[model samples]
Target: MTMLRRNLMHAKRYPSMTFSVVVMPVILLLIFNFVLGGAMQAGVGGDDSKYINYLTPGMLLLLPAYMTAAIAVLVSTDVTKGIVNRFRTMAISQSAILTGHVMGTLIQAVLALGAMLGVAALCGFRPEATPIEWVAAIGLMLLIVFALGWLSVAFGLAAPNPESASNMPFPIIMMPFLGSGLVPTDTMPVGLRQFAEYQPFTPFTETVRGLLMGSEIGASGIISLAWCAVIALVGYLWAKSLFRKQSR
Candidate 1:
């Protein structure tokens, strides 16, 4: 708890990190929904005004990716500043350091997601989910944030500096664009379509879309959970290994 408070307080002291995490997605939401929404809707056979409904789910996925960069940078900053070494001298559990970063990122991700959803609502995004579906959607999103938070921690611990850490997760932020987030995969060329359909973000976006819009979830919910589990496991193991090496 002490470590967690320290992480959160550090974020509070540096508001720009939190601001970027929240604002980037919202800015993209506005640009996509207003500037390119008509062309995108035409391509996808959707109403221009209704593009927000389609875009918002994918935007939700971006929140975790954005938060990942912030967490990574923050983690790398701690390492570079010798804060982690200082903590190592203390009597606290070693795992608390990473856990604090993961939990802090998760909390910030959730709040940023909520703010984006509110912005989506203002932009004419109306979900057809029932109360139960809302709960399920929230749960799924939390799982995504949790999984990605650990991944960010690993990225942070692996990078030698904050600048590299920030750059490492750029591919993650771009995954949504390559997937079915902006438009249907069917609209893409053969090779691109195949990649878009098979990527993790596609199912993640699809599952959320299904839950919010009352569409068929089919196997996407299960696939999404499986992906989250794999990512979280890999991230946990990698982070543990890296931290141990650093401790020596």
Candidate 2:
């Protein structure tokens, strides 16, 4: 609780970091929902409002990827500023600082997701899922945020500095473009289609889309869960090991 409060205070002091996370996705949501929405609707065999249903789920999933860079910057800043060293000398739990960072990132990611959802609602997104499905969707998103947030921690800890840490997660921002987020994987070339079909973000987007749109989520849900679990485990272990070395 102490570390979480401290991290939240740091975010309050450095509002740009959190603001940047909200800005990029909100911009993309607007551009995609208004400018490209009609064309995309035509491409997907749906009306403007109907396309919003398909588009918004993918956008919701995409938000976390971009937010990873923000987490990377925060983590790298703490390490570079010798905050980690300062914490090591304290009597708090060794993992508290990292846990605090994970919690902070999750909270901010949820806020960013909420902003996207609000804009999406204004843009004509109305999901058809039942109450249970909505609960499941929210749980899935939280799990994804938790998983990816840890990966960002690892990225931050691995980077030599904040700038590099911020850049390390850049590929995550592009995963949506290359996957099933913006378009169907079947429309791509054979090789790209295969890659898109198998990528982590594709399953996530597809699963979320399925849940919201009343489509089948069986396979995609399983794949998404698997991907999240693997990424979270790997990232948590890597970050823990790096932080331990830094403390020593």
Candidate 3:
């Protein structure tokens, strides 16, 4: 808990980091819903004004990915500043440092998600979800944030400096754009369509969309959970090994 508090305090001191995390998604939501919404909606055979309904879930999925850069920078900053080494000299749990980062990022990610949802609501994004469905939807989003938070930790630990750490997760941020986020996968060419359909973000977007908009979830929810598990396991193990190596 101390470590978590410390991380949150750091975030509080560096408000720009948190602001960036919150602003990017909100900006994208506005741009996609306002600027290119008509053309994209027409491509998807939907009304331009109603694009917010389709875009909101994907934008929600994006909140975590945008967060990865900030989380990575924070972890990288700690390591490069010798803070992790200082912590090692103490009698605290070794994993606490990394866990603190993950928890801190999760909290910020949730808050950012809420902010994006608010902006989405103002942009005419309405959901048909019941209370139970809303709960499930939120649970799924939290799972995604938690899983990605660990991945960002690993990225931060692996990078030699904060700058590289910030760039390491760029591909993750692009996943939503390549998936069913902005447009339907069917409109793409065969190769791109297949990739978009099978990517991790597609299932994440689809599952959330289904939950909120009353569409068929089919296997997307299960697939999304499986992807989260795989990502979290890989990230946890990788970050643990790296931190241990650094300890030596």
Judged by lDDT, which candidate is best? 3
Off by over 4 Å in 3: none
Model 3: per-residue lDDT, tens digit, 107-139?
887788789889999999999999999999999
Each prediction's number of clashing residue pairs: 0, 0, 0
For candidate 2, write residues 133-204 as lDDT tens digits.
888888899899899989999999999999999899988888888887777888789999998898899999
What lDDT score is found at residue 194 in candidate 3?
Answer: 95
- Per-model lDDT: 0.90, 0.87, 0.91
Query: Could you tell me which 10 consecutive residues in candidate 1 have the lowest summed lDDT?
Result: 42-51
Quote model 2's TM-score: 0.96
Model 1 TM-score relative to the real fold: 0.98
Runs in model 2 deviating more than 4 A are none
Candidate ranking under lDDT, highest first, comes to 3, 1, 2
